[model samples]
Target: MGLVLGDAWLWAAVEWSPPAVAEFYIGGGFDTPTVVALLVAALVKAALLWLILRAPAPGPLDRRAKALRRLLYLAVAYALVLRYPIALLPDAVDAAFQLALWTAIDVLYLLVIRWRSRMLRAAAGAVFAVELAAMADVLLDELDLPELGSGYIVELALMLGGVAATLITLVGQRRDGRWSRGTQTAGWLSVGVYALVFPLDVFGRMSGGDMTVPVMMDALGYVGTVWIAATARELPAEGRPADLPPARRRVIRVAVTAVAVLPIIALIHPEATPHLTYTGWSMDCYDRPSFGDLKPAERDAAFLCRARSTEGGVPPMFPDSLSDQEILAYGRALCRAKDRDEQRALLTRAGSASARSADQWDLVYVCPEIVGAAHPELLWSTTEAEAANAAYIAEKNAKCRDPWPRTKGVVQATANYFLFVDGDPGYLVHDPEDEAADEAAEQAMGKVYDDSTRVGVTDSAVLIGHVADVADVCLTVKAFRTPPPQRTAGWDQVNEVPIVSRSGQLTVPEMGEGGEVGAGAPMPNLAIAGKGRYRLRVYVRVDDAEEEQHLVVVFPGASRKRLKLKPRPVAGRALSFNSPSSGGRRAVARGAGGRSQAELWS
Candidate 1:
């Protein structure tokens, strides 16, 4: 007993560690303590039943008679309560069904043991067959064939055959007074083994594998149950002790049978993480809407834009700005700026030219770096005043029992467009009164655009802007890469910066420091051919520290004339970018200036 208990202890210790046990307890209905208690109870019950069956036969309690009684007891437990519970839980519900499956398989083993009469054996086999079929069905489903859901005829045949065989045997052995001691023990032991293996299946599910442990356990349980039944009902083997009570023998048989199941259960959890698991983004978000219940398009758009804005720039993978050669010229000038003042002046001149060009040609453009800052307004959101107003509107919905929590701070600024207002201060009108008062409020606080108009469609709470066709005009922006007010210096210590598109793919060619790196110097300008979309994906690395990447997409048809957004500082160690509208010929054409080719212009 000590050795047996030690084996159980040692194995369980390694198999069910604290973390694994806790996860099991939380994920399943039963905790470790309760499961242990149940396991102990099962052994005790089996032992007691075995003891009863093996007790000395009073008067007419012959071997055959005792077997009949055992068979009757096991049969009753099956038809009504035992068998059905296995099917009670829904398929998607993992834990409860798993428990039921193991319990049912164990029951089959027990039935096979207590019934020695050929008829009773057949009856038990029938029940086992039904369960076996079900197990097969489960396996086939795991294999993932489209037809598996419909039902497998082979499984059905096995189940029906077992049922028929059992019925015939029961009729022929109607009066058999013997139960198979071997089957009874085998069945009980099989269950104990199943108890150990059950958690492994659950763990597999957690690690994203199909739960097929039950089927495997059932297969082994079947053989053990049959063997136990055969041993229990064995005819006095020539020199065997005929005086031994049937019940006692049944207990001994079951105890030994349980040993057969131990190794299999112990081996269940060792399989490594499956080759594939449906976890990560697919399980969490892609399969269903995780955040707000937005549509696929809306979510995709929001996600792409938010990602770009977060990095403070649009993706540069697609060159929507001046071509590589032209950008190289600008880059050369930018890198040559010796002092902070010089850097700012050089960047400002380039930025102004880009901005004016964007404005004049209606071409979307972005200064790779303005004042040594790329996309300084990415973090900007609705102001507190506007947030308060949105809250007020939300309260109105709350009062009406149609609460729609105001998702304030939902506004995001795009590269070519700015978010002017999401929920601006005084955005919602709570009161309507005299004509004069209403007129004043409307005149003073009327929104310039609504949701639709904000995106350049209809009036809305959000607004975006883009350059118009032929909006080419040179405008300068200042840069302060170095510390405060200093004299302008030409590029000297700057290094070439490469931009990337939204896909993390590099777009522009390496640009060197052109002599153009001067404050108030005109940046190489380019024009958009038509109402095409574009994004400026720029990578800026100053003084060889870290590279800062920005991706911006400009939807000419979407933006308004101008957007009002607070300039916010970029707050990350490494800045990256992505924009959806930065692909294809929508980008700026190279070589617009007379002297320099597009590739060599920058």
Candidate 2:
């Protein structure tokens, strides 16, 4: 009972270890809450069992009971090693540690077996010896092992140990005339557990339906350990002589059969046998707001279906009902419907016929009309969605269509730089109260031609400068492997700026419609390598827009505007310098000696 209670406590710690234990217990150096809890509980059980052992009770300790109690302590130790800690070990050492640990526990188990007669004890010992021999490679230090190979050997040894023990018990029972189906021993029952649990564990873990595999496995193992101890405890002194009642014997056989069948049924239909299970968490689809309650088989089918349906998108999972299938098929059907009335008809028919929930949620975008009052958020009118979508695209087109017009060298332009593609002095006329969205759009645009020459360039057009009043301004670009020495002393202004590229291409786009945001189309294609620093030299004779020859010297360096050549104003940024009132040209502020404030000439 102490052993079982101890297991219960440890199992609680295991179940709660993740969030609960991790949330609270962060003191010990080990940092493993489950391990600490398990070890502590196991130790407590050991102490309690030891106290029980030492307590002088009656004549002699019932030898079989004493053996079983000692075995319970061994089982407690086994339980300690049974979970979480072993998994935390490095796989290289995990195998070796597992072998050593289990070997020690098995050795302890061997020392604890107290059979009725000398021959029984000797037979058990001999069977154990053979089992140990079969697993000799585990203790043998020279055996080279793969990663987890030793662990596999340990598992095989355990299974083989069970097989050997069961066989020996059966042979001995047969020889001693103790063989009786009605009162089959624990060893006979253990074979079923060993056989069934391995497959169940494998399938359950791989089932994908089971979210609580680790917790459930630990729990089932704990139960199995308790059952083993219980069976061990039932061994009688003087072996329950031939005077044992037939009714009691028959009851044992029935109990054994029932016990063996119950667990298998529980694994297959855990929802039906919820009492038998440890963890209640699973994809049972029972209480979820799907449609209605699922029968046990339907629930099981849906759970496994969802689990195994690991395809591209969420696969259609439903109980075996054509009505459910029809509801699932409605997603595609509504999309093909001619109009809202037709869609409503299709949805109503399906909804009336089946109680299954819509399988694909994202399909709401396709079939929005089906999103009735139940899901009010999705109850958006088609016109509203289209309007919103059109608004979204128009906004994208307005903001992302072209790069901001910017000027390079000093002397601000009187005309030519169109601040917006739509020729709006402010911005998209559609956005009145939503200037914040426009501002967000501009910030996302990533390039700004502010009052400062030392500017943060974006992947917008590499450079947009203002060369005023050009009949046909000749713009030629020269790329440099290394920066050529600057000769802009005589030049009007030299603006050294950094060129930024995200698409890996930079270019001087002709004054036209650039494509959408990041995918800006350059002159037909693109070039000037990648993002790097550039130095632009502007030469002007003060009135040179007629045949302005602008030579942009591109190089990899840093950005530093020619300071003091143009002093920047604190405020009064023009919405568009290319004002419609200015005969489709930009107006600039002129300062001392008729010199313009700020501009990008190219």
Cα error, candidate 1, residue 373 (Å): 30
lDDT of 2 by residue, 1-602 (tens): 32254434444444534434433322332224445545565554454344223322223345545654565555555555544665675554554554554455455444444345777767777666656554544434335543222455565665487577656655544444422332235456556556556656756654544323434344434434443443343344344324348887787678678757866764564433222221112433333222123343353334333322333344332222233334335556755566667655764564333233333233443344454323433334435444543444344234321111242322111211223222221111011123243343244233334543312233232333332332122333444546655555433434554443334443442333221111111221122445444443322211222223344545445655442333332233322223133321111110001111111111
The stretch of ten residues in a row with the least summed lDDT in candidate 2 is: 588-597
Give the runs in model 1 whose Cα sits over 4 Å from its true position.
1-132, 135-177, 200-602
Off by over 4 Å in 2: 1-72, 78-100, 103-223, 227-249, 263-336, 339-455, 458-479, 483-496, 499-554, 562-602
lDDT of 1 by residue, 344-431 (tens): 4654554432221111111112222332243222211225323443343334223221011231111111111110111111111111
Which number leads on lDDT? 2
Cα lDDT, all candidates: 0.31, 0.39
TM-score of each: 0.21, 0.33
Candidate 2 lands at a TM-score of: 0.33
lDDT at residue 86 of model 1 (Cα atoms): 43
Q: How far is 329's C-alpha from truth in model 1 (Å)?
A: 53
Q: For residue 530, what is the lDDT in candidate 1?
A: 29
TM-score of 1: 0.21
